[model samples]
Target: MEAVFLIIALALVLMVFAPVAPSDRARTPLRLRLARQLHLWDRYVYHDPQIWYPRD
Candidate 1:
């Protein structure tokens, strides 16, 4: 049926565009993870936007 074909087509499109999972080697250590999170929070979340923009 047309409905079945449409569902299959949508599933195929989503499969092609889905994000791949990070590999084990891509995982960061705990200290680095915490540091990155804190840095982002400080720069973006807790900052005074009128005085600062994010650096590259």
Candidate 2:
């Protein structure tokens, strides 16, 4: 009975603290990659000093 209780307790501890393995699925899809490029020009404009002067 004590052995069974210890086993259950150990399993509960592992379940609570174990890190989940990441899935084999891709994080970003092809559609999202294409959509991200659409904002590339806007990103460059915002970050470029030539387009917008940075106040130091």
What does candidate 2 score on TM?
0.34
Give the CA lDDT, 0 to 100, for residue 31 in model 2: 56
TM-score of every candidate: 0.38, 0.34
- lDDT (Cα atoms) of all candidates against the true structure: 0.58, 0.58
lDDT of 1 by residue, 1-56 (tens): 79976875575556444544466555556566556555764675457765456556
Worst 10 residues of 1 by lDDT: 12-21
User: Which residue pairs of candidate 2 clash?
Assistant: none
Model 2 per-residue lDDT tens digits across residues 1-56: 79976875576555444444457854565455445543664576578997577677
Candidate 2 off by > 4 Å: 21-56
Best by TM-score: 1
Name the lDDT of candidate 1: 0.58
